[model samples]
Target: MSRAGCSACVRAQEQLAQILADYDLRLAVVDVDQLAEQGDPLPRAEFGDRLPVIVLNGVEHGYWEVDEKRLRADLDALR
Candidate 1:
């Protein structure tokens, strides 16, 4: 998940882009504020304060930053 104008979110996305393809992974960037405006406030409520939340396989992996090392390990385990 992410929010508009969030620098951390941008950085996280960039980091993911660099590595996801190597692991055959895909990323879905959800804007928390947009969810709230659409009346589905769960994501914003659950993670509003933490912009740039990274979720892998429906499980939250990290927030504020992309932990590439740990994420790569998790992806490896999934295979």
Candidate 2:
């Protein structure tokens, strides 16, 4: 997920962790600024502006916040 120092990202991360506790999932946190420093080129354009993004199976979910109900449903469907 694209996340910076956003409180929403923190909450989302916690919620998602709780939701997926039953399953074996991998969560990767990529710092936008750090990525740019490493020559990511268009960091903001790529994900900086879109902090708190969720990528489900390589699909861009969205930004802003996390929906607990929706997340649970998605997880259920995956199983």
Give the candidate number with the greatest TM-score.
Answer: 1
Off by over 4 Å in 2: none
Candidate 2 lDDT tens digits, 35-61 = 777887575567667678876776766
Give the CA lDDT, 0 to 100, for residue 60 in model 1. Answer: 90
* C-alpha TM-score for every candidate: 0.94, 0.75
Lowest lDDT 10-residue stretch of candidate 2:
41-50
Candidate 1 lDDT, 1-79, residue by residue in tens: 9999999999999899888989776778999999899999999999999888999889899998888899999989999
lDDT of 2 at 75: 73
Residue 39 lDDT (model 1): 94
Cα error, residue 49 of model 1, in Å, equals 0.3
Q: Candidate 1: worst 10 consecutive residues by lDDT?
A: 18-27
Q: Model 2 scores what on Cα lDDT?
A: 0.71
Residue 52 in model 2: shift from native, Å? 0.6
Candidate 1: list runs displaced more than 4 Å.
none
- Clashing pairs counted in every model: 0, 0
